[model samples]
Target: MARFTHSNKHTYTGTLLLLSCLALIGAALIADFMLASSSYSPAYLSIASKWAREKSGFIVVPNLNASKVGQKESMAVKDKAERIPERSLSATFADLPAPELEWEQMPSAPVPRLDGAAIQIKNLFYVFAGYGTLDYVHSHVDVYNFSDNKWVDRFDMPKEMAHSHLGVVSDGRYIYVVSGQYGPQCRGPTARTFVLDTKMRKWRSMPPLPAPRYSPATQLWRGRLHVMGGSKENRHTPGLEHWSIAVKDGKALEKEWRTEISIPRGGPHRACIVIKDRLFVIGGQEGDFMAKPGSPIFKCSRRHEVVYADVYMLDEEMKWKTLPPMPKPNSHIECAWVIVNNSIIITGGTTEKHPVTKRMILVGEVFQFHLDSLTWSVIGKLPYRVKTTLTGFWDGWLYFTSGQRDRGPDNPQPRKVIGEMWRTKLHL
Candidate 1:
């Protein structure tokens, strides 16, 4: 019985030795495959390293293509870092390196008004007639002194001068005030043209327009005062008439305005600018608020206003050519231009109405029109949305004051007309 038991034990020991040898041979095959194959996965390396550590008590380092793996990982990180999110219409301007762009509020004007015209001569900003509260029209001039940062002077305008919508321009010393609405709301325009001598602070009559116009785009170009586009007598119809007259020393050389080529798209509240003798008209609306036919012409309604972004330029060849339209349509932005870095910067006007609310949408963006490139870009924004904002540029600063401000950020409807002035440094 003892001899039979000893034989069975010997057979069992031999079987165990055979199984151990086969397991070692299988592990050797797996290790060889992991080291030899270039396409071996990370999982294979992990399993091989685990087996080697458990059996031999030594770590197995993977022979991965370190350079290629590093390069691929680095490229993935770079791509993620360089990705830029898409911007929206209301996005803030960020083309240039951002500077300190906070707006500083200045002293408010004496009286709040809208549709006013302002021009800077030296250090003085002359604010002309505008529409006041409750159908009242301001027929006076408020002069602001930059040195003192205060409203320094106030003077009465000519009784014959129109109260609002006057096309005003300055030639250092002389200010040409052209045709405009003579009275309050819905009043017919006047053909009487006047020039203000800043040195003398005196008013002189110039050759009147062939017919009166409302908010005509007026600018001085090569010794000639050019006037083009405005609303007609009905206050709703657009007038495409263009006229000019030779002028030296604020007085027209001719007795009558010579008719010239009409503007392509005629409307009111457009900015007229002359850069390098090139005439450009931009941003106006076709229809204006119309007066309801009644005993009093003060009652009005904005039933048919259509703002547009169309831009037109009159070249030296005496032909009008269409330029690229604005980033968005704008109106009630007459006389809003500040020349900086070979570009014209316009700010704050009425854009198209809100799609959902059907209310007027005021513009808060600072638009830059590059003369060299003829391109439009939203460079910055205002503190809030506004329309008819009086603009001035002085000593590396852009100033704006006196306009109708929007209700709130959530509400685009216009709320109140303000005379508060604000300015920001132009980091050119």
Candidate 2:
């Protein structure tokens, strides 16, 4: 094994050098094994699993980031998965020096902004684009170097990306961003793509999305970046067109936009992730509940709210199937996910009446999904129930910040916009 010093204070554990080499082996072996056994491919997965054992940590969790996201049970006739052990994972949110959230006075963003965002990388937090009240995507990028307990402005996103369909993922090198919205109010057609080099402070353009969609939760699977559901033309008619682009040489491509198997016409803004070789999508706005076994995407549209406990998964053959469903119907939260102890650990998102609601509401909550049995249940709740704009997990503890809550229709109601703050761990 070879070791090299990374500028970031956190130690890399000497495994990153061979990460790509091992990933290539895993991909190749898995592909071959799939060819031999159409339906079953264990031996190929074994090779990939072996390579993953050594290098997955470097690629998956390179540093500490703040973000956060689940499912239910089923035991029907043949080929049904068994009951998963209902787990209540006690979270471990580390306490920060300063306390921000309050019930009386409105908490303010470290910087006055909403929709502007943050990301954690190499043991630090980076805040970027969010729209101002006048509706302009800020070009300045503010980074919270948690290690040094200070804020630093590194580099702005490729261009102005405000109210855009934001999706970001990192491979410990480049911070790949997909965000673009056009028009006067930013509620227009947007098609833009950019890649930021965290080290060199550079940005590059790539192929844009086939359509101008926003607010879709993105999932990275097997070296390819997948953009999940988000609404485009008609907010009510959410697009199930799943778009993906291959990334190579520190660049994310916009071309080769393949709209594979559409989701169950279950609407958009659902929490999406690929776990254990299966893609799991949770919750969305305005979709049917009573979907028959082999029904099309838009099966039931009578329901008012598209949100539901419905959790869908795509098998190896790319067939969409529903899972046990969630504890309740939830949509439009800062739903990011991280795996802990073989369970999906989901953290803070706005589960209230509105994402920008300023009034006090208990939307800050956490839950888990046990892959083995695949059941859903609440684990713990955030100490302060606030609808944060964004969430991500890194290093161990979960971090969330930078979103507005309803201030209510009143006189001089101040909306709280957090620049960057971490969880106060109510009861981890």
Candidate 3:
């Protein structure tokens, strides 16, 4: 009986040793497979390297040589500003006739206001969400039909987003309203983002912006919504941060906010437009308005602020190239800017304070920049001096409406506001 019990114990000890050896062999095989895969596969090496970098707090700079190939292929961008024509920065209006344009008067808008954004999509012009008389902020949406040539009150905005100064961009179907100011009294900024579907005429909330801002030069580029240059609280606090949101199938993707390098100062009220693969940032105000003797409320500056005459172009490589400054600095306000007939047309903006009166004067000047020639020329002037006019371009017509007229001492509003809608066939 003793001998049989001893035999059973030996058998149990042998089985335990075999199981332990098998476990170690399995672990060894797994370790070998992992090491082999990582050493042989580029993808595995990349993922492991990324993980290591994240854990080690080390950043690996991309190889510039490898990136250039992808950049040239993906963007198909043109060369730098060296390609532009070398000519006099200022164009002369000596022989240029009044631009070949046909003027037409449209029906009055239900709400006569300024500081509102006008965007045209498929022949329909949507205009509203600006301050009215007596400092009244509007939430109503007013749409104008080109075929019918009439204005219709469509619907109210989801919230009070008046005087935002921020503009809207479209992806052929959805119109995105970016962050803007909500305070009607102080003209403060807010970080509210929304989108409106023209088909349904409904506004839906999207992710809010990283910071509150107003008057941002926003646009759609390369399937992303690029929000650049504005102000945080007032025009003084220039928004230096650049953010982009990737939208897929009319919806902003989750966790898609990308922060790029900061732009130059004086970003507010700047005219930003994407031509081909380059983004052109034109005149803007460097400083903001401050209180002065006799003028207690908000009003235009008195020749104290710096108006940017410098034209900055952002290339496909994300580098900014300085172009020849405009002959006349037309910053501090939004100029009538449009790209047409391979030319850039800007007109009717307030210039620096009049040399004599020390008061900023409304301008009636019109200028054109030829893309092919890379030259600028004076294209005569508008029929009337105008500034801060809500403007848009569709097909071949440039639409402008309801700008503030110069106010005299008797006027109650700081500036006299208008409500007229005018359209003209712009010869590019």
Worst 10 residues of 2 by lDDT: 62-71
Q: Give the lDDT of residue 144 in candidate 3.
A: 84
Q: Which candidate number has the best TM-score? A: 1
Number of the top candidate by lDDT?
Answer: 1
lDDT by residue (71-146, candidate 3, tens digit) is 2333434765422212111111111233434568878777777666667677787776766753566677788877
What lDDT score goes with residue 226 in model 2?
Answer: 75
TM-score of each: 0.76, 0.61, 0.68
Model 1: CA > 4 A from native? 1-100
lDDT of each: 0.79, 0.52, 0.62
Model 3 earns a TM-score of: 0.68
Judge candidate 1 at residue 237 and give its lDDT: 93
Off by over 4 Å in 3: 1-102, 160-162, 290-304, 332-335, 407-414
Deviation from native of the Cα of residue 386 in model 1, angstroms: 0.5
